[model samples]
Target: MSSSIWSSLPFVAIWSVGYWAVHVPHLLFLSLRNTIKPLRPVPQWSYRLSMGTAVLRAVFRYIGALRYQQPLQLTPGRSGDRFVRIAPPADANLFRGVFGAPSAMAKPAPVSAVWSPAPVVAPSSSHPSDGRRRKVVIYAAGGAFVTGFDPEMSSRFTSALVTSEHFGATNLLFVQYRLATRADPFPGGVLDLFTAYQHVLGLGVAPADIVLIGDSAGGNLVLALLRRRAGLLALGRNNSRSGGQDRALAHQPVRHHGRAGSVLGVDAYRPKGKALTQEEEGYISPMDHPFRLETPLYIEAGGAEGLLESIVTFAGQMADVKGNRVQFHITEDMPHDFFVAYPFIGAKKESCEALKRAKLFLEG
Candidate 1:
């Protein structure tokens, strides 16, 4: 009886191992398929593979199956190219936190080439302020810490603004920043942005005269600067023709002013709380900063972005503040970074309208 039991134990163990081996991949595949079902007309095979990887990553994420709590290391390839070793962070909720770890600790291999500054559109000699026909405007493009900053991505708005009937002859200083990846983390790009802002500020333009315009991530930075008084937030209260007042009201939902209003007022319109701890929220959030409301600011974001909560929250906070002057343009049905896809299906007529509104808000 003892011998039979021993033999049976081994057989059962083997069978169990085999059963899991056979089912695990299928389970992972099914989970991936179900997750991506909403994203159909499921492209070609390569696209499917990429999407499948993204989906599987999300699956591993939802169940908390990952072993590592932070991003994996990257290593240099044969040709001095950097390659990430572990799978990219899954697009799960925890993915951002995991990927948000400092790049120094993560030890991603360095790329040989450094990102050079985008060609600075020099202020034309013909600026009206300088008795010339040109105006110098700063353009900050937005991405949710991950993607974008390509020339094509910025061209739609920049080209139009530089050549528009309203904003024509305006020279653009397009500020391009780094992105968060397995290599780069949060605040890496944001720091670069401040450097760019300071560089522009050093160019002798008064903070009040500089028209700062940014969308999405760039918008967040603009508001951050405004909140920090790194520049200003031009409130549209002065001009009847300006759209800033309307946008500010629409961006923030009004609540009764009360005892809680001080804590939860316009300052709450920023994207700092909820998912973040009090300390983390305080450190990274623009709302936590002080402001002077010096420059005319134009900020916009898509209605469908997850960050809309923070955007509206920060906007509300700004609105509640006694002297902060900020304006917001919330475009409907627009997803995060929708402007990057200009001339694509997502760039609806409303984008044009938003640009027009932005131009008027800035030029007014």
Candidate 2:
């Protein structure tokens, strides 16, 4: 609720409480009805979640918070691993990693002297993956790009992943990429992810040992980064003249609530108020131009998700790629990002099963 209000008007949060208080009972009633007569199999609390999320979506889209970069507290929770802040990769490593060294590379972002330091979630110290430990999960948090590290869902979901012996991840790096609302969209998040990946490499973790994990919009960025790493899409300065790598860096959404929630999400892919062109839409959607890639992937989607059909089709394309390992899982009864609410009341067994599947996929 306060997330949508401007910092200057802190009173709005106080005053808005009365309005929410009045509606609580009504919302609960609706939530109850949803559970009794669910449109599809979902957790009992999911009804309340949907109601709350609808309001949250409106708050972010209507309150205009999406236009600015709000403060972020990158807490690592009780995992005993702190978030490690590292300097952005030098021009040589980032540029040369995705594409051959350029004669001159543009600074994608302002230098540290001019901007705040790069913030990344610290890899697990207790189970550091530096050769001795092995694999690490680079977690990209889902908040529709408006919210960073959604306190509600991310904590529950991530905690389960890290604690589970099934997942067997000793280290996890949660990337604190800039949000679209901060006036950084498209390549901004990907660029930060690339730096995080390289930073982990510098830590002596093997590339094969790294597992990219994300949900919702964060999941999309993970998918894009996978392609970027595989040399399908380059994440660098947008150069319209060059194709594949150079020209490719230029974004195309080429491209969202329940009904309205979907709309709010689409806007996050571009600058505020700016509409997406056809090619730009394509850039954000990996399914649009599915191609061959050797990078292994695990894709999960709800059978009830509007994007389920498309997600399945995309995974099929990836599976067809020669020697590419793909594990696709569908929880037919849950909604999109249902795992975020994880092991909650109604979805406990289902959610745990999903995580177990992910662990097996990664290990195998």
Candidate 3:
């Protein structure tokens, strides 16, 4: 080989190794963390093979490469990330006497990522004032029900939220729920989500001070949670939203879809298994629930995403039912999860505006 070519080969080899080290492990960990069990459990060897393939894909990102377009600029926050296990009240008892209670409590499914804002450099940029209740945002990520949670996406988004002048939130918790698979599908993931919500509440944050945010399937979970809360309150009021019951239950949660099922041959895009009935699917929807909520809800969606139709329908129905309590921001021509791309895409202006509105909603 020529001298020039030989000299340049080392740099190429070093770059390749660096990329492999960072990205391959990420894909592998994700595959393992969100394992798919078809019937009972995925066979050990098959699981390994599946993860190996995923890691390999990460290592070689482009087997059939397409010509690259202009890169989008994303201003991800410098927020610190931490992992913690959240357990139900009963589960907390199991760790009471354990030497490694924290570790033991963390072993269960549905790990969470906590992102703390960067230290304030400017006095004017400090956290919310003492008079104002510090906002605590519990974010759920969107990935059509089948895909598992994305921590990087969640962290990046949270970082943006807390660092930006719009939100200036101090505490952000991103829940990583079990993804839908053959063994753990549909409502199974929803249960884990409920536990996550309970865990947050257990931390003593008032339901009124909490802001629930979700995209795609995560959006589905958020709606489900509010619905459940509304249902509970309604039951206490004799399931009536009229007369004395309405006045008495005014403080209860007022409840408030997305797409990809088309490719899967199922309407809900549920995990690979049996299909769900319209009523069963509707049960998971946030639109069906009716009640009033003290907490404000902020929803962001791209107009171009597959789930736009369902999302628009849900937003419209909820807005009519709950009035100003539900806020919806739709960005034309944008795809799913546009907030994560706030710094780069042409649609970022709308995304940023949506967040600003969300901030205002929270302040009120």
Question: What is the lDDT of every predicted structure here?
Answer: 0.42, 0.53, 0.48
Deviation of model 3 at 102, angstroms: 29
Q: Model 2: per-residue lDDT, tens digit, 273-303?
A: 5454543343466665664443556677766
Report the error of model 2 at residue 309, Å: 2.4
Model 1 / residue 194 / CA error / Å = 2.7
Steric clashes per prediction: 16, 19, 4
Model 1, position 183, has a per-residue lDDT of 31
Model 3 worst lDDT window (10 residues): 243-252
Candidate 2: give its CA RMSD in angstroms. Answer: 8.0
Q: Show the lowest summed lDDT stretch of 10 residues, model 2.
A: 246-255
In model 3, the Cα lDDT at residue 208 comes to: 54
Kindly indicate the candidate among 2 and 3 with the higher TM-score.
Answer: 2
* Residue 297 shift from truth in candidate 3, angstroms: 3.2
TM-scores for all candidates: the values are: 0.48, 0.69, 0.57
Residue-level lDDT of model 1, residues 325-358, one tens digit each, is 6567787645444454444433535556666676
Candidate 1 displacement at residue 102 in angstroms: 15
